[model samples]
Target: MKFLAITLIVHTPHPATGVVQSTTERFREVLDNAVLAEELGFDGFGVGERHEWPFLSSAPPVVLSHIAALTSRIRLFTAVTTLSLLDPVRAYEDYATLDHLSGGRLELIIGKGNGAAQRELFRVTPEDQWARNAESYEVFRRIWREDKVSAVTRFRPGLKDAEVWPRPLQRPVRVWHGSATSKESVELAARYGDPLFSANVTHPIEPYAELIRHYRERWRHYGHDPARITVGAGTAGVYVARTSQEAVAAYRPVFEGNLALQKSLGLEPVFTTLDDFVERSSALVGSPQQVIDKVHRYHEQFGHTVLHLHADAGGLTRTRHHDSLTLFQSEVAPVLRRDIPDPPFPWGPVLHAPAPAATPLAR
Candidate 1:
């Protein structure tokens, strides 16, 4: 299995302390984490796009460009580029430029983004967002696969033999549809035979699992090779310690504090307590073995070959944060890599050589 460390660059105050980092400091922290993820041998690092308060990840291409300069090997990803809010041609040009800068190591996970703020900021309504997402993706993919394109689009101006400059370096970059609580994204992925990445952080496994099943069914309907379908999943959070007790003790407050944040946002949370969150939600907070077991349980449902963990420190102290992730890399990650079958998307146009899972000291 391939592992990725991704952050939305949330700029919220510390859940427990109410302390917020300056925007500059927070951005630097993101850059530093990208470097650390590469150093720790993560397969990829992803920056998310969120155009709302308490989220500084409004421009993923700019963030990923800086990350490309810092890491030589780890692939770069957009957690879920808000294609619904972007002009497909402009988006294509930006990512195509990034592909060259990253030496053909850029992959995208596209979606119709969520949030009331998206409507306010981008003037895209929920009623129309999915349609915009689908149309934009169609044009975006065409830009990558074809030299010039002519098409009529409702959301954007018509294109006629338009050549998007600085053609992509990857022959064609890989795109993974980001599915959350919808069949539209799944259907789109299946229609194109592209991979699907589940935003599995919210709610329970059943909803996301149902989406994957739909994806597989549609893939067969579309006459794509079943063996070529790829899926990636995200955990709500991850923290490991020597024992479950220690891990729970460390993460409980963070969980409760975030639950409070959820209430403050006026959205009812599905997992109300730490126990429930650990038991049902996709958070991986426990001893190394317990975390591994939970992943296996999720795998039984998700069949995900790529797994992403929260990249930020969240509410943990720097020491605990670094140690927990390092321990996971040294202990938990190798086991999954050994046991899980490899998915096809990781082998891009320019295949990267596998690196040691972790440094000798970490092992």
Candidate 2:
């Protein structure tokens, strides 16, 4: 099994204490955590993209490029680059450059994205988002796989044998489609034989499990080999301790603070209480063994070889949060490693140097 420490770089006053760090401090915190994620032996570290308030992750490529300089082995990921709001050509240029700068250690997860403010800012309506995302991905994929691409695109200007600069370091980087209860995303991923990463954070396991099932079903329908299907999943949060009581007790305040923040933002809280969140949602708040058991239960349905835990402390003190992650690395990961099968492909990039000029990616 592979694990990632991912952050959306949420920038807000402390939910518990109402204390806020300056923008510089928040960015440094993300960089420091990326380095620590490498030291803690996580397989990957992901930075998310958002164009809304309370989130400082609008430029994932810039953040990841800095992280690339700070760490050597940990693969850098765009937790879910919101392609619907971006120009595919520009996005490709940025990430391809990042791939080279990172020594070919880059992976991407693309999504339609959420948030009303961002949708308005991009002028991408809910009805238009999925189509825009699909269109953008089609263009982005072609630019990555071909030296010169020609396409009549709707959202973006048409391309006519356009040559995108500085071909990526990876012969072909792995791209995961981020699906949050969207059949369009599942079908798109299946049609292209790419992996699917489920946003398993919002609701109960059943909805997410059903989405995975749909993805596999469509994978087969698309005539892709079932044996080659790969999947990854996300958790809402994680905080492990020596005992379940201690774990829950410590996380309860954090949960309450988040709930309060949600209400203040005029968003409905999914799991009204901490107990419900732990029991129903994908949040892992328990002893190491208990967390292991919960993951196993999800794996039974998800068959996901990769999983991600939140990198931020949320409202918990930095010391407490780091200790919890340390415990996870020490006691939980090894057991899961022995139990779950590894991902079908290597987590890192395949090649480290420039591809042949004008060469299209090979299957």
Candidate 2 per-residue lDDT over residues 296-357, each given as its tens digit = 99999999999999999988889989999999999999999999988888776777433433
CA RMSD per model (angstroms): 7.5, 2.9
Show where candidate 1 strays beyond 4 Å.
350-363
- Report clashes for each candidate as comma-separated counts: 0, 0
Give the candidate number with the greatest TM-score: 2
Where does candidate 2 stray beyond 4 Å? Answer: 352-363
Evaluate model 1: give its TM-score.
0.95
Give per-residue CA lDDT, model 1, range 1-363, as digits (tens).
999999999887887788989999999999998998889889999999999876899999999999999989999999899999999999999999999999888999999998998677989998999999988988887777767677777899888778899878886688999999999999999988899999999889999999999999999999999889899999998889999999999997679777877887788999988998989999999998998998899899988999999899888887888898899999999999998877964455543322212211120
C-alpha TM-scores of all predictions: 0.95, 0.96
Q: Please, what's the RMSD in Å of model 2?
A: 2.9
List the pairs of residues colliding in candidate 2: none
Worst 10 residues of 2 by lDDT: 354-363
